[model samples]
Target chain A: MIQAQSLTKRYGSKVAVDAIDFTIQPGTVTGLLGPNGAGKTTTMRMIVGLDRPDSGTVLVNGQRYQDLRAPLREVGVLLDAKAIHTGRSARNHLLAMAATHNIPTSRVDDVIELTGLTSVARKRVGGFSLGMGQRLGIAAALLGDPGILILDEPVNGLDPEGVLWVRKLMRHLAGEGRTVLLSSHLMSEMALTADHIIMLGRGRVIADAPVSEIIGQAGGATVRVRSPQATRLATLLAQAGVTVVNLEQDVLQISGITAAEIGDQAAAAGVALHELTSLTASLEDAYMSLTKNEVEYRTGGTGDDEFGDDDSDTTDAAADAAANDDPRETELQEAAR
Target chain B: MSTPTTLAAGTPETLADIGTEFVPASTPTGPHLNAIGIIRSEWIKLSTVRSTIWCFAVLLVVSMGLAAIMAFGLDLAGTDIATVPGTDQARFVAQASTFGVFFGQLIVAVLGVLVVTGEFTTGMIRSTLTAVPKRLPALWAKALVLFVTTFVAGLVSNIAAYAVTVAIANGQGLHASLFAPEVIFPVLGGALYLALVAVFALGIGTIVRSGAGSIAVALGVILLLPVVLQMIPATWATDVLPYLISSAGVSMFGLIQFAQVPLDWTVDLIIVLVWVIVSLGSAAVLLKRRDA
Candidate 1:
C-alpha cells in the first residue's frame, strides 16, 4: 500500500503538485489521470523519494522509501523509460540493479524472459526502440518482484499486442494482492484497465472515484434504440427529465434513463424494437467535462466545449460517432450483439 | 519471433509463476545491502562501461610510453652530471622517468569526473538512487571504486615507467637504485598524486553534476587557474601558486621544487585533502536536499 499525505511540490513560483492526499490500496490497479503538466509525474517521483516534497510525506507500506531496508524488494519504481545508461546491455543493466540488493543473476534472466526481451537481452539499450525501451523499463521494475509498483506512463509507446499484454499483466499483478499505480494520458486505456482512477487538474485532484462511478457521474448511462416506430417511441420517451436525440428516421438516442426502462416503455406502447443498447459515457467525455476549466494551456476562444456547440448537427453527429468508437463501448456493443 | 517455450506454453498462469522460481528458496539471512554489496555493485557499473576501460588504457600507455621516450631522449643528450653544477642526478632521473605524470594526471582526472557526471548526463542516476535511496552510499561507493581502480592503475603504470626509464638510462651509464629513497619516494608518490587527483575530480564531478561543466572546472582549477594566478606580480600570488592543486601535486610527486617557495610533501597532501573534503561535503549536502 502507498499513502501520500498532503504531498506538495513547487518550483520557484509555480506549484507543481498542490497539497494532495491519496491512499492506494493493495489488490487493485489505480490509474493516475491528468493532462500535460498536471503534476502526475511529480507525485510519483515524490513517492519514490526521487523528489523532495515541499510539504508532506509519502510512505510505502508504512515506511519512507529511503528508510526501507530493502527498497527494491519493497517498492519497484520506473519513473522514466529512458532513465538508463544506454551503453549497458539489458542483462547487464538488470544485473547491476540486482547486485545492489544481492539478488541472484537467475532472477535477472527471469525478468528478461518475462518481459519478452530475451531475444535482445544481450544487446545495448541505445539501439532499443521506444517500445523496447519501455519493455526494458518494466523488466527492471519487476527485477525484485516488489509488492508496490509505481510506473509513470507504462504504455506510452507500445504496440497493440504489447498494450494488451500490459493490461493483462497489470491485472495479474493486482490480482496477486499487490499495489499497482500507473499514470497515463490515454483515457481509453485507463478506462478499460483501471479499477479506480484519481484525476488531477492544475495540481489538484479534481475527481477520484471508481471507473463505473466516474463514467456514471459524467453523464448517466444512455440507451441507443432502433425501432420501426422510433418516432412514436421518441415522443413517448420525451418526459420531464429525459433527453431523446433523433439520429435517423428510425434510431433514437435516449439519455437520463436505463435500457430496461426504455425497453419496457417501448413494449408497453406497442413499438417493435430492433435494437436497444446501453452506452456509458466514454472516459474521454467524462475527463473533458471534469477538467475542461482546469486545462493549463488553452487556445483562446475555444469556450470549453469539447464537442463544439450544442446546436450544430455536424458536431453532434461527429461526437456520437467518436463516442461509439471507444474500445470499451465497442466491447459493449459486441457483447450485446 | 518464436516465443520462449517457458512463457509461450502458458507456464506463467499467474503473477506467482512469473518470477517465483527466480526467488531464492530461502532469503539470505543477514543484511543483503551493506557496504560490500554497494562496492561490488559500483565495481560492476564502473567496469561495464567502455569509456572507463578506454580511459585507464590511455592512462597506462601514455604514462609508461611517454616515460620511455623521455628516458631515450635524455640518453641521447648525454648530459655529464659530474661537470654540471647544482644538478642532482637522482632527482633529474626521477623527474625524467615520471615526466608523463603531467599528461597522465589529466586522463585520470577526466576519468574521475566521468565516473559521477556520466550517470547524471545519461539519466542513470535515477536508477542508481532508486536502488540506494539513502543516497550517500552511492556516492561513497563510487568514490571507493574510482579510488581503488585509479590507485592500482597508477601504481602499475608508474612502476613500469620507472623500470623502462632505468633500463634506458643504464645504457648511458647513469645508475639509479630502485630502493634508493629518492627513486622509491617519487615513483610511489607519483601514483599517490594521481589517485588523489582522481578523488579530487570525483568530488568536483559530484558538485557540478555535468560532464562538460565538471571537466571544465576540473581542468580550469588544475591547469588554468595556476597559470592565471602566476601573472599577478606579488609575493602572495607566488606563495599561493605553490599551494594550488597542480603545484601541490608536483611537490608531492617529488618533482623539482618551486625555487622561491617550498612546502613539505606532508603539507601539500593536507592541502590537497582539504580540497577533496570541501568539494565532497558540499556535494553530499546538495545531493540530499535537491531533487534528483
Candidate 2:
C-alpha cells in the first residue's frame, strides 16, 4: 500500500505537483490518469525516491521508501526505459540491478523469459525499438519481485498482442495481493486495466473514486430525443421541469429526466418521436467532464473556463443532492449527507 | 484470537534476531558492492569498448616511434662528445624514455574522460547509480581502474622506449645510465606522473559531467596556462610555472644538472597531491548532491 499525504513538488518557478493526496490500496491496480505535463511523471519519481519531495511524505507498506531495509525487495520501479547503457546487453542490465539486492542469476533469467526477451537477452540495448525497450524495463521492474510495482507509461509503444499481454500482466500481478500503481494517458486502456482511478489535472487530485463509481456518478441520466416534433417536444420537456440543450435542429438533448419518463411524457402530449435514447457517461466522458477545466494544458482557441461545476457531471455534488430526494447513488449518499 | 496467530507469523525480525532466526537478504546486509566489485564492473565496461583498445594501441605505437626517430637523429649528428654542453649524455638519453609522455598523456586522458562521461552520454549513469547510489564509490572505482591501466601501460612504454634508446646509443658507441638515480626516477616517474594526471582528468569528467567541457578544462590546465604564464616577466613566470602540476610535477622524474634551479623531488610530489586530492574531493561532493 502506498499513501501520499499532501504531496507537492516544485521545480523552479513551475509547480509540477500540487498538494495531491491519494492512497493506492493493496490487491488492486490504481490508475494515475492525466495528460502530458500533468505532474504524473514527477509524482511517480517522488514516490520511488528518485526525486526529493519539497513537502509531504510517501509511505510504501507503512514506511518511507528510503527507510526500507532492502528497497529493491520492497518497491520495484521502471522510471525510464532508455536508462540502460547502450553498450550493455539486456541480460547484463538486469544482472547489475539484481546484484544490488544479491538476487540470484536464475531469477534474472526467469524475468528475462517472463518478459519474452529471452531471444534478445544477449543483444545490446542500443538496437532495441521502443517496444523492446519497454519489455526490458518491465523485466527490470520484476527483478526484485517487490510487493509494490510502480511503472510510468508502461505501454507507450506496443503491438496489439503486447498490449493485451501487459493488460493481463497488471491484472495478474494485482490479483496476487500486490500494489500496482500505473500512470498512463490512455483512458480506454485504463478503463480495461484499472480497478480504481485517480484523475489528476494541473498537478492536483481533481477526482478519486472506484472505476465503476467514476463512470456511474459523473452523470446519472440524460435522454437524447430525436423526433420530427423535436421543437414541440423540447417545449413540453421544458414545461415539465427538464432542461433541454439543442444538440441538432432535429435532436433535443434532455437532462434531469429518464428516457422512459421522457417517452411517456411525449406519448401523453401526442408528440410523435422518431428516436429516444439515454446517455449515461462512458469512462471517457466521465474523464473529460471531470478534467475539462483543470487539464493543465490546452493547445489554443478552446474556451478556457471549461469547469462550470453544474449539471449531473459533478459526481459528488449530484450524488449528495440525490440522497434526500432520489433515494439512489447509495453508500456514498448517506456519508455525503 | 486468530489475529494473534497471524501477527506472529507475519512480522519481520529485529536485528537482534538476525543470524539465529532470519536472514532477510541473500547477504545479511543489503547490497554488497565493494570497491573490488565496482572495479571489476568498470574493467568489463572499459575493455569491451572498441575505443579503449584503439586508443591504447595508438599510445604504444606513437611513443616508441617518436623515441626511435629522435635517438637516430642525435646519433647521426655526431655533435662532439668532448664538449660538456654539446654532448650531455644524461640529458640526451633521459629524454628518450620521457619523450612520448606528452602524446600518450592526451590519449590516456581521453580514455579517462570517457570512463565517467560515457555513462552520462549513454544514459547508463542511472543504472550505475541505482545499483550503487552512494555515487563516490563508482567514481572511486573508475579512478582506480584508469590509474592501474594507464600506469602499467606507462611502465611498459618506458621499458620499451628504454630498449630502443639503449640500442641506438650502443650503436653510436656512447655510454649512458643502465642504473642512475636521475635515469630511473624519470622513467618510473613518467609512468606515475601520467597515471595520476589521468586520474585527475577522470575526476574533472565527473564534476563537469560532459566530455567536451572536462577535456577542454584539462587541456587548458596542462598546455594553455603554462604558455600564457610565459607572457609575464621572466622572474615571476619562471617561479610560478615550476610550481604548477604540469611543470613542477614532471620535474620530479626529469633529471636536470644540480646547478640548474629546479624544484626538489619533494616539491613536485606536493604539487601532484594538490591536483589529485582537490579534484577528486569536489567530484565526490557534487555527485552526492545532484540527481542521478
Candidate 3:
C-alpha cells in the first residue's frame, strides 16, 4: 500500500505538486492519469524519496522509503526508463542494483528472462531501442520482487505486443496481492488495464474513482434528433436537469433523456422525426473534458478555413458540457476533500 | 494459424516441458543490505566502467614509464654533485625516480571526478539514490571504494617505478637502496598523494555535477593556482604559496623541501586531509538537501 498525505513540491515560485493526498491499496492496478506537466512524475519521485516534499509525507507499506531496512524488497520504483547508466550492459546494470540488496545472481537472471530481455542482456543499454530500455527498467523494478511497484510511463515506447505484455503483467502482479501504481497519458490503455484511476490537473486531484464510475460520470448517453420542428422539440425537451444543444436548424443534441423518450415525445407532439441516434461517451472524451481547463501549454488558434466554423462550435459545446456537468462537479469536490 | 488444442497435444503439459525456466516458484529472500553490500556494489560499479579502467591504466603506465625514461637518460657519472652547491644527493634521486607523479596525479584526479559526475551526466544518480534512499551511504561507499582502489594502484605503480628506475640506474654505475628514507618515504608519499588527489577530485565532482566543470576546477586548483600565485608580487602571496594544494601535495611526499615552507611532511599530510574533508563535507550537505 502507498499513502501520500498532503504532499507538496515546489520548484522555485512554480508549484509542481500542490498538497495532494492519495491512497493506493493492494490487489488492484491503480492508474495515475494526467497530461504533460501535471505532476504525476513529481509525485512518484517523492513517493520513492527521490525528491523530498516541501511539507508532507509519503509512505510505502506504512514506513518512509528511506527508513526501510530493505528498501528494494519493500518498494520497487522505476521513475524513468532512461535512468540507467547507458554505458553498462543490461545484465551488469541489474547486477549492480542487486548487489546493493545482496540479492542472488539467480534472481537477476530470472528477471531478465521474465521480461524477455534475455537475448540482449549482455548488450550495452545505449544501443537498445526505447522499447528495450523500458523493458530493462521493468526488469530492474522486478529484481527485488517488492510488494509495491511504482512505474512511470511504462508503455511509452512499446509495440502492440509489448503493450499487451505489460498490461498482462500489471494485472498479474496486482492479482498476486501486490500494490501497483502506474502513470500514463494513454487513456485507451488505462481503460483496458486500470481498475481505478486518479486523475490530476494543474497539480491537483480533479477526479478519483473506479474506471467504470469515471466513464459513467463524465457524461451520460445523448440522443441526436433530426426533425423539421427541431426548435420546437428543443424547447419541449428544455428542463432544469437536461442539456440541449442545437447543432443545426433541423438537428438537436439532447442529454439527460433517452432516445425512446425523445421518440415518444416527438410522436405524441406530431413532429416529423427523420432520425434519432444515441451516442455513448468514451473514456477519451471523459479525460479530455476533465482536463480541458488544466492544460498548461495550449496552441494558438490557427483559424484554418478548410474545416469551417462547425468544428470550433463542437469543441466549445464539449468544453461547456464538461464545465457545467453537475454530478462531475460534486464528485470533484468530494475527491478534493 | 495453429490451434491451442493442436499445440498442446504436440508438447508435454509439465512445467519442465517449457523451453525456459522464466518464473520462480516464490520470491527469494536474500540478505538485507548493509554498508558491506553498498561497498561491494560500489566496487562493481567502479570496476565495470571502461573509462575507469582506462584511467587506472594511464596512471600505471605514465608513473612507471616516465620514471624509467628519466632514470635511463640520467648521466650521473659525468657530473659531480659537490660542484653543484645547492643540489642534494638524496632529493635528486627521489625526485628523478618519481618524475611521473606530476602527470599521474592529473589522470587520477580526472578519474575521481568521473566517478561521481558520470552518474549525474547519465541520469543514473536517480536510480542509485532510490536504491539507497538514505543517500549518505552511497556517497560514503563511493569515496571509500575510490580511495582504496586508487591507493592500491598508486602504491603498486610507485613501487614498480622505483624498482625499475633503481635497476636502470644501477646499470649506469649509480646506486640507491630501497631501505633509504629518501627513497622509500618519497615512493610511499607519491602513492599517498595520488590516492588523496583522487579523493579530492571525488569531492569536487560531487559539488559540481558536470564532469567538465569539476575537472577544470580540480586542475585549476592543483596546477594553475600555483603559477598564478607566484606572479602576484606580494610577500603574503609567496608565503601562502607553499600551502596551496599542489605544493602541499608535493611536500607531503617529501619531494620538495625549503626553509621558508611553513609545513613539514607531517603537517602537510594534515593540510591535504583538511582539503579532502572540506570538499566532501560541503558535497554531502548539498547532496542531502537538494532534489536528485
Q: Give the interface RMSD of each candidate.
A: 7.0, 6.0, 8.2
lDDT of 1 by residue, B1-292 (tens): 1221232232344323432433232223443566777888888888888878898888878877887888888743555745543335566567766777788778988999998888898888999999999999988898888888888888788777778887887777666676677777888888888888888898899889999999999999888988888898988887788778778888786775653657788988887788777877888888888889
User: What C-alpha lDDT, on a 0 to 100 scale, does residue A134 get in candidate 3?
Assistant: 92
DockQ, candidate 2, comes to: 0.21
Off by over 4 Å in 3: A220-280, A296-320, A323-337, B1-30, B77-93
Model 1 pairs in collision: none
Per-residue alpha-carbon lDDT of model 3 for B1-292, expressed as tens digits?
A: 1121212233354322221232222232556668988899889888888888899888888877888888878865667644643324455567766677788789999999999998999888998998899999999999999989988888787777877787776675556676577777888888888888898999999999999999999999988988898889998888877777678888777666422845778888887888889999988998898899
Q: Where does candidate 2 stray beyond 4 Å? A: A61-69, A99-101, A220-282, A296-337, B1-36, B76-94, B163-184, B234-236, B255-260
Model 3 clash number: 0
Q: Candidate 1: deviation at residue A153, Å?
A: 0.3
Question: Distance (Å) between predicted and true CA of B92, model 1?
Answer: 4.3
Sort every candidate by lDDT, greatest first: 3, 1, 2
What TM-score, to 2 decimals, does candidate 2 have? 0.75
**Candidate 2 chain A: 10-residue stretch with minimal lDDT:** A328-337
Residue A86 accuracy (lDDT) in model 1: 85
Q: Which stretches of candidate 1 lie over 4 Å from their true place?
A: A238-242, A264-270, A296-337, B1-32, B75-93, B259-261
The full ranking of all candidates by TM-score, starting with the best, is: 1, 3, 2
Better of 2 and 3 by DockQ: 3
Evaluating just chain A, the predictions reach TM-scores of: 0.87, 0.75, 0.76
How do the residues A1-337 of candidate 2 rate in per-residue lDDT, one tens digit apiece? 7778789888897888887787676678999987677788888877866667889887766566655655667666877788777877888878766755567799999999999999999998899999999999888888777777898888878788888898999999888777889987778888899999988776777678888878776555678889887777776766444567666768877678889988999899999888899876567767776665554234444554364322234445434443233333232222222
Expressed as tens digits, the lDDT of each residue in B24-96 for candidate 2 is 2222254444556666667766665666787678878877877798788774465556554423575576688
lDDT at position B93, candidate 1: 68
What DockQ does every candidate get?
A: 0.31, 0.21, 0.26
